[model samples]
Target: MTILRRLAAAAIVIGLGMTALGLAATADWRLGLIVNFRLQLLFGFMILVAIMIAVGDRRWLVPAVAGLAINAILVGPWFGFGLGTSSGESVTVLHLNLLAANRDTAAVVELLHETDADIAFLAEATASWRRRLRLVEIPFDVVATPGDVRFGIIALSRIPVETRVLGVSTFQLPTPLLSFDLDGEPITVMSFHTTSPVNTRRDAARDEQLMALSDLVSSVDGHGVLIGDLNATPWTPGMSLIEDAGYQNSLRSSGLQPSWPAGLGPFMIPIDHAFHSEGLEVIDRRTVASSGSDHLGVEIELAVKR
Candidate 1:
């Protein structure tokens, strides 16, 4: 019995230590592996507690309960908050990656109109897809560069776009960086579908594109909004680099919501995001319903503070 008590105490101490380490090492880029390992320790601790409970070890159960309580207090709320709120005079924008396989253009278009976003950015748009989008009239001004496999991006805006440009050879992916003026407010927006990191070649290409995009955003003179299917999560190291470059994540400011692999279970990761500069106030944010696409649409409203 004494030996069991000692083992239980050791487990509790180790679990708490790992949790603390994870929280502390989160800010250091070099300690990413350490942080990840600490997270694993937390999970392992839970598994150990379950085993102890199954074995009917009452002495070990006390420490197990305490460890769980600590984890709940620290890590549980990280997944629960909604995105930020905004003051008046804000424009809402929607970002969606209509997958190449998705054919429900009508439903997507209707949702775009229903959302009443000031601007809507859609990726994986082909020439035919653009024609279908023309049926929706809310976005009077539209810009698109259609590709062979419907892998291009299109921006539809209610406000007149004064300037627009496609990022030339930014990366292996043929995505574009678009800039526009909203009633004298200069907003630079980029819509991209980086190569997924499922393969080495694709992952390298995606990382390069992200680096280039980060450079472009940093060099811009005015407010910027980067909306797209980044194919990377906010918690990842690459995304952290972007965060370091003076832009804030829209979802992280309010909540950490996952938006991916639609039709699957809820244990999803947030790969699609809209990041903005400090000049904008994020009012409201939400994820739209699945439109036969693997990814769900994310909408963010921002007030351009003068």
Candidate 2:
């Protein structure tokens, strides 16, 4: 009886610790610690379950089943499943992280032709890559400013672009904000690749960029859409600021779909996202095939409410 009591106590303590670690992973700003905490929680739960099995405790099964069910509901859609319907005026937008080191430019172009998205956003692009992409006979006008090291972004549109604005001042952070007028209606779109918080300098710059971006989006005079590799998740506080600025997540309204660390096992994190203002509707969303990049591609079709 004493042995059983000691085992139960250990199990309870471990379970509580796992729960706390999971919560901390969600709340903490430090990226490394956050990842570590999540891993700890995941393994900690497994350990607790193993202990329960060893102790032959049937009562623990109830909570274990409930926890697994909740996790499934939260994470099942990340496996490239669609959650909603497309609007009648739907225009497909594809966001891809073309690894800078990739050499198969022809393959990339072929994939673009195959998908035939109405608009395409590419990150980590280089001048050579942009030149290579220009050779593809896609019916689109392309705008790109290739970067040497970091945060290179590009946008291409099949429809005629009436106006294109690049780079509005954002709290001295050099992130580009691109906007275009599509189909006689102005759609303000911004593609951002914020500094990853893994390092101190990058983290501070990213935070500043986010603050400025929130202010810019809030001040926009018309409908707007923001998309890119945010390097953060919907549940994060930084994302909360963007949500508070009146933008709705295309995924959250449908489901939380993780889209990062492509091919690094099934447990993914949602770093790439699409957030839009009230005048737009998300018709459909899915992840595209990987292109040798660490991040997977996200494709979203959105409609302007006429």
Please give, for residues 8-117, the per-residue lDDT of candidate 1 as tens digits.
66777777766665556434433333343432454666776876777687776777777677665554544555444444466778888888778898778677768768
Query: Cα lDDT for residue 161, model 1?
Result: 60
Ten consecutive residues with minimal summed lDDT in candidate 1? 30-39
Ten residues in sequence with the least summed lDDT for candidate 2: 31-40
Q: How far does residue 10 in candidate 2 sit from its true spot (Å)?
A: 8.7
Q: Which parts of model 2 are misplaced by more than 4 Å?
A: 1-55, 58-87, 135-139, 146-151, 163-165, 168-185
Instruction: Kindly list the per-residue Cα lDDT of model 2 for residues 173-250, writing each as its tens digit.
Output: 233444555445667766667667776666666667666667878977677877888877654456667878988778
Count the clashes in each prediction: 2, 2
Top model number, TM-score: 2
Residue 131 accuracy (lDDT) in model 2: 74
